[model samples]
Target: MSGIYIHIPFCKQACHYCDFHFSTSMAKKDAMIAALKQELVLRKDEFKGDTIATIYFGGGTPSVLTTTEINDLIATVYSNYKVIENPEITLEANPDDLSQGKILELSQSSINRLSIGVQSFFEEDLKMMNRAHSAKEAEQSIGEATKYFDNISIDLIYGIPGMSDARWRQNIQKALSFGIPHISSYALTVEPKTALATFIKKGLIKPLDDELAQIHFQTLYDVLTKAGFDCYEVSNFGKPEFYSKNNTAYWLGEKYMGIGPSAHSYDGKNRSWNIANNPKYLKAIGEGELPNTSELLSLTDKYNEYVMTGLRTIWGVSLDRIRSGFGEKYYVYITRQMEKYLEQELLVVTYGHLIATKKGKFLVDGIASDLFMINLG
Candidate 1:
């Protein structure tokens, strides 16, 4: 089954560490929504033979849009595409935007799931990250949202400069108190030209501590696992029957069409991305053109991507798949590279799949890169 990812590019305010494609100004929200609907209509035939099983509303903040605006977008999808019955629809939201009235309205809408951006339940961490919501709002939003949606996921950040182990533990405990079914947490990274990077460069804020982040990750894995959560993917934990279908589909290499500025698409061969600039995107779409660049994937590119994504999840690299799909050369190369990691107890071939061991979970990216084929014809 295929999926659709709609990127809402408007945000009420910018987070200090974010480098995502988004504009703080909502002056063009109407135009942007129209363009999004138009894009969906334009790309309806892209996934002709496949039924869309998931629809994800991700962005600067999907909650920023009114319920009517979201419903219209969904209506366009239903009108244009072959959406499956009861598709898993998700909207990424910010706590500040999830007021009780808004939550109630959304609960009545077609959106079945919500992914809240609650970075922390502590005021200092919230301020440090420049999140728009206060700690009280973070707790309150979740408290209210839970009454409406059962399939809820929240995002939390670790490795903030002054976040302590005790504080991190408290954050996890607080989330558990809400009985949230899924959690996606990540270590804070300072991207170039982001406020976090500039602050560090100017000595205004302390630099991120990688070692500390690693420690925090390990602690998180331990805590969640003990709470009966599955570390199904790196940085994602889910209780039984609550895994994110949209994310799982993407990781398993399902084809999806992304609409709106800075959105991306894959059709099993070529990958494309929309223009990141809002005005440029709108003008092009209005002129009956898609403002995007495309690339057809080569065999080498596909193989490397498979290796990268496969190693990060519980579903490890399949030796049988490698041999059948990529040829014996790639299979043999992978087995050869496995010798070193297997020796170090970092990876193990369990049931013909190369799974990362506990020792290698935090270092999966580096390990996958080491196993990548630099030159394959």
Candidate 2:
């Protein structure tokens, strides 16, 4: 089954460390919604024979849209695409936008899962990240949301500028206190053009310590696993059935269509992304033109992508599939590259599958890059 992702490019404010595409203005909100519906209708033929298993509302905080608006978007998807019975419809929301009343309204709507952005429950961390919610609001929103929704996930950031190991542990424990079924955590990274990078360049904030981040990742894994959550993906922990269907479909290389500005779509062999500019995207859709660029993946590109995504999950890269799908040459190259990591116990071969050890999980991305097939024309 495939999925549909709708991107909402409006946020109340910008986060210091985020470089995602979003506008702080709501002047064109109505027009943008119309464009999104039109885009879905325009692309319906792309998934003519596929059944949609997940409809994900992702973005600059999808909660910024009213429940009516969200339902309208979902309705558009239903009318245009073939959706499965009881599909997983996820809304990425922020604490500030999820008041008690809002939570109740959303629970009554067609949305079944919520991915709340509660970066941290500390006042200092919230202020540092310029999150729109306070510590109290973060806890309060989660508390209220749980009363109405069982499939919920919260985001947490580790290795923040001043976050100590003890504080990181507390953050995990606090999340556990809420009886949440899923948690998506990541180490803070300084994107080149974001305020976090600027602060470090000017000595206003200390540079990120990779070693500290590694330690924090281990702590996260240990705590969550002990609490009965599976580290199904590198940064995602869930209780068996609560894993994110939308993200899992993408990671597994299933076909998906992304609607709205700055969204991305993948159709197994080709990938495409819409324009990141809000005004330009709106104008193009208004003119009945798709403002996106696409590329057909080379054999090397497909193999490399499989390696990159496969290593980050509990499902490791398959040796037999690699040989049969790509060819024997790729299998040989990857097996040769796997020697050093295998010797170091960073990567292990289990039942013919190449999997990362716990020691290597935090470093999987770098390891995956090292194994990339390059210049194999």
Candidate 3:
């Protein structure tokens, strides 16, 4: 099965910690939508051979698009691609965009699921991150969204340095009380060139401590797991039947077509990404060029990707799949290295699937690297 992703490259404001491709100016909004539709038609046959099982509208902020825009985009994909019956269509929305009317409109659309970006439910954290939505709006939006949609997933950010451990517990409690199905919480990351980084350097904002992040992470796991949500992937938790299928497909290295600026696509044999610059992308695509770069995946590179993605979630890399797909020697070496971690309580082997233990989930990158088959040649 394949997936389709559309990136809506526009935001109402520049968020302090956001490095995502977006423009505060909506000058090119209409043109970008037209260009995105055109790009879909231009590359119609890229994944035409596979059945499209999922379609994800990620952002900038997908909810910024009007209901008419949302409908039209879905129409284009259906007209151009082979979509499966009842596909898991998801939209990454922000709280400020979700009103009762908009939620009602979304309920009638093909979007069966929503991934709401409700970073926190407190005004202090909202201001700290410079998020466009207020805490009241965030809470009300979740309530409103659930009235129309049952498969609602809200995102929360933790370890903000401004939010204390007690406050963090309250955040978790608020989400749990909301009765939402899925929760994809994250530790605050200080990316280079983002406002958070600049502020920390200027001493205007405190930096996130590793110890604080660790504590927050552990607290999140404990709270969510006890609340009957599976820690299906690190940083993602879900109640019964609420895991994100679209993201799961990506982590599993399933083929998908990404249409828009700064989006990436993978087809098992090759990987590609579009130019992040909005104007450049629109110009190139408008001129009938694909406006992207591609790379053929080598055996070693593919193996590394597999290890990296698998270790980050509850599904650890399957050595059997590696042997069949990569080769015997590489597969043997992967399991051999994983055996070392297996002894250290970092990974657990159960039902023939090696999963990272709770401890291992904390340092997933390191464990995945140990099992990774690098291109040392």
Candidate 4:
């Protein structure tokens, strides 16, 4: 089974640290929606033999669209693609857009899951991030949404420049207070060209502390695991049945089609992405063209990606699968690389899977990179 991801490339306002493609203006929303539906129609054959197991509405802010508009897109998917019965349909929303009325409307629609962007429950943090919602709105939105949807996820950011350990603990406690089943949290990283990076460079904001972020991640894992949430992936914590199927599929290397500007798609061996510019994407789709670029994956490309994604999750690299699937040389290289980490207790092989140890969880990315199949043809 595969999935389809629809990128809603419009937001009411830009967040300080975000570099995702989106327009603050709603000027072309109607046309964009039409182009999205058209793109789905144009690409349906790509998934002709695969059943769509999840339909994810990710975004700049999917909640900005009306319920009718969202349903129309779903209807288009249903009409064009082979979707599973009771597929996981997720809508990524912002707290400000999830008012009581909007929540009720969405609950009654085909959308079964809601991933709300509640970056923080602190006023100062919200102000620094330029999130459009207040602390109260973040709390209130989740409270209202819980009344309607049980499969809900909220985003939380940690390691804000001035966020203390006590404050980060408070954020976790506050989220648990709402009985949210799933939480996706990440450290605040200053991406190049984002406002956060500029502010740091200008000395208007403190640069991110990697050491602090690691502390926050450990705190997050400990607290959530104690609360009976699974650290299925480094950044995602979910209860038994609440793991995000869409994201899990991606991590597992399943095929998925991404629709809209700057969205990406991957088949078993090839990957593609749409043009990032909105006007160009719309015009190309209107003119019966797929404005995208593609690349066929080399064996090394596939191996490196698998190692990178695998080590970041509870499902570690399968040494047997690696040896069998990627060949003896790759298996040997990885096992040789594994010796040092295993000695440090940063990684371990249990039941034939190479999993990251608790101490190494925060450092998995760097470790995975070190184990990458670089300079190998």
Candidate 5:
């Protein structure tokens, strides 16, 4: 089965380290929504073979949209795609927008899962990130939301300046204490052109220490693993039965269509992304054209991507699948390269699956790079 990803590109306030395509202005929201609906219809035949099993509303903050707008988008998806009976519908929201009333209203929609962005439950951290919500709101909102939706997920950022390792640990314990089933924790990366980068460059704010971030990540893995939360992906942990189906679909090489400005669409063979500007996207779609560039994946590109995405999750690259897709020689080269990591205790082979070890998960990208074939084609 495939999935649907809806990108809502507006935020209440800009975070220091955010690099995702979004705007703080709402002037184009209505027209953008209409354009997104048009884009959905225009791309219905992108993936014709599989039925949609997951519907994701990801964004600058999907919660910022009115309930009517969200439902209309879902209605459009239903009009074009053959969605499964109980598709996992997810909306990525921020703490400030999720009130008890809003949570209750969300329950009335097709959405069944909520991924709340709770970067930190501390006022100072919130201020540092220029987040619109307060620390108290972050803690209280999730507690209130759990009463309405049990299939909840939270996003936490670690390794921020002034957020101690102890504080990060407390954050995880707090999430578990609140009975949140799925958690997506991440390291603070100061992307270029973001506020954090400027501040660090000017010495206005101290930069994040890589070593400390690594320590925090190790602490996270240990605590979550002992708490019965499985590390299904490098940056995500979930209870035994709480794996994110939408994200799982992406990892498993399933095709999905993304709608809205800066959204991406991937069929099994081709990948495309819309322009990052809302006005540009809306204008193009209004003219009955999809505002995205497309490129067909070369065989080498596909193998490299499989190695990158697959190695980050529990399912490592399959040599057999490689042999089948890329031929016997490619598999032979990969097996020879994997031996070095296996000897270094970075990868473990069992059940015919080459899975990344706990130690390897941290360096998964680097390891995958080493295993990449020059010309799988």
Candidate 6:
């Protein structure tokens, strides 16, 4: 099964720590939406024979658009693409946009899952991040949303500069109390060129401590797992049936089509990304052209990608698959490289899968990097 990702590259306001491509103005919303639909119809044959299992609306904030606008896009996909009978259509929304009226409208739409951006349930944290919604809105949105939608996920952030452990725990507890099936929590990273980075540089905000972040990660894993949620990915915790289908397909290396500005697409051998500029994208699409660039993947690039994605999920890298699919040379190299991690008990070989140990889960990215084929020449 394949998936489709539609990027909505507009937000009401820029968050302090965000680096994703987006515009704060809605002046080009109509033109951008038209361009997005055109892109979908243009690339419909890319996954001609495959059935679409997931359609994800990700971005600056999909909820900013009206339900009618969203439905038009969904109808376009349905008319042009081969979709499954019951596909998981998810829309990423912010708490403030998910009012009772909005939730009611969305419930009647094609969207089956709600991925709400409830960064934190604390007003101070919301202020620090410059999120559009307040803490009360965060709580109320979920409360109102659950009445209509059962399959829902909320985003949470940890490791804010002055956020204490107790406050973090309360955040988790507050989320859990809602009986929601999925939670995607991430550390507050200060990306380059972001307002958070500038603040840190000027001492306007305290620098983030790695040790504190690590502690928060552990706390998150412990709290969620104890409540019967599976920590399927590093920052994702969900009940077995509630895991994100779109993201899981991506982690498993399944093919997907990404539409709209700054979106990406992969089809096993080649990867491409659309232009990040909104006006440029609209102009190109209006000219009946694709504003994107692509490159074919080398064997070394594919191997590293598998290693990176495999270790992050419950499905660990298969040594046998590496040996057979990538040739025995890669298998031998991996065997040798993994010896150090195995000796340190950071990784374990169970059922021929290179799964991370509990002690290594928090540092899996570093471990994966160490095992990368750097001298791929």
Backbone collisions counted per model: 0, 0, 0, 0, 0, 0
lDDT, candidate 4, 1-377, per-residue tens = 99999999999989999999999999999999999999999999999889999999998999999999999999999999889999999999999999899999999999999999998999999999999999999999999999999999999999899899899999999999999899999999888899989899999999899999999999999999999999999899999999999999999999999999999999898999999999999999999999999999999999999999999999999999999999999999999999999999999999999999999999999999999998776
Alpha-carbon lDDT, every model:
0.93, 0.95, 0.89, 0.95, 0.89, 0.93
RMSD to the true structure for each prediction, in A, is 0.8, 0.7, 1.3, 0.6, 1.2, 0.8
Where is model 6 poorest over a 10-residue stretch in terms of lDDT?
Answer: 368-377
Predicted candidate 3 versus true structure: per-residue lDDT over 1-377, tens digit per residue: 99999999999998898888888889999999999999999999887678899999998999999989989999999999988898999999999999999999999999999999989888988998999999999999999987888899988998788678899999999988979989998888898999889999999998788888888889999988998999988989988688899999999889999999999999889999999999999999989999899999887888889889888877777767878978888877877888888899989887767789987787788788878776532
Instruction: Please report how far candidate 5 places residue 297 from its true position, in Å.
Output: 0.7
How would you encode candidate 1's per-residue C-alpha lDDT over 221-276 as one tens digit per residue?
A: 99998999999888899998889999998788999999999999999999999999
Candidate 2 lDDT, tens digit per residue, 1-377?
Answer: 99999999999999999998999999999999999999999999999999999999999889999999999999999998899999999999999999889999999999999999999989999998899999999999999999999999999999898789999999999999999999999999999999889989999888899999999999999999999999988999999999999999988899999998999999988999999999999999999999999999999999999999999998999999899999989999999999999999999999988999999999999999999999774
**Residue pairs with clashing backbones, model 6:** none
lDDT of 4: 0.95
Can you list the residue pairs that collide in candidate 1? Answer: none
Residue 173 of candidate 6: its Cα lDDT? Answer: 99
| Per-prediction TM-score | 0.99, 0.99, 0.97, 0.99, 0.97, 0.99
Off by over 4 Å in 3: none
Model 6 Cα lDDT, one tens digit per residue, 271-351: 999999999999999999999999999988999999999998888899999999888788999999999999999899999
Candidate 3 C-alpha error for residue 14, in Å = 1.4
Clashing pairs in 2: none
Look at candidate 3 and give me any clashing residue pairs. none
Model 2 lDDT, full chain set: 0.95
Q: What are the runs in model 2 whose C-alpha is more than 4 Å off?
A: none
